[model samples]
Target: MTDTFLIGMLVLAAGLFAVGLFGVLARRAVLFQLLSLEVMLSGPSLAFVAAGARHGDPAGQGMFVLVLILAAAEVALGLALYLRMARTADVTDSDSIRDLRH
Candidate 1:
């Protein structure tokens, strides 16, 4: 593949990042925000893989794998916390989870 293809992949990944950002900012559901955050994380991971392919270096691929693992851990922790919150509260809206004291 040529540099154009790699650049295209990067552009596509950037688009995904932007969409994910919008979802995180615009969505009301905490779960939806978390899902969007994961997508945002994965987009860069994909970009890293594409860059690694272009440069013929395994480091980028290794970083991508590490990021995947980190994303998985993040989802696991986030889901556990979400489940706890859901059990205690009837709402899952991100805006409604404010428990901070005035």
Candidate 2:
């Protein structure tokens, strides 16, 4: 039963990762892109936890926590950049952001 549960959790995490990747590739909207990034980061965190549980190891949990911190920092920086760009360009699309170079 435990093995089955672990496999299911891993499969779900993989699916989340795939969806996040697809969203990043296919979405043009900045907000959707950000959301997809979050999903991508979170999927691995969940997988880490599941792996730790399956292996009975504490290091995986620790790694997951570190990854979470990194993800938070990334979100902060990304949001700050988006805010600066939005203020100057008055648009949130990535293509329009190119106007900021000049």
Q: lDDT for each of the candidates?
A: 0.90, 0.86
Tens digits of lDDT, candidate 1, 1-102: 799999999999899899889999999998999999998898899899999999999999999999999999999999888898888876588778775333
Q: How many backbone clashes does candidate 2 have?
A: 0
All models, RMSD in angstroms: 1.4, 1.6
lDDT of 2 by residue, 7-89 (tens): 99999989889899998899877878888998998888888899899989998899998998998998899888888877877
Clashing pairs in 1: none
Off by over 4 Å in 2: 99-102
Each candidate's number of clashing pairs is 0, 0
**Model 2: lDDT of residue 11:** 91
Q: Lowest summed lDDT over 10 consecutive residues: which window, candidate 1? A: 93-102
Give me the displacement of residue 23 in model 1, in angstroms: 0.7
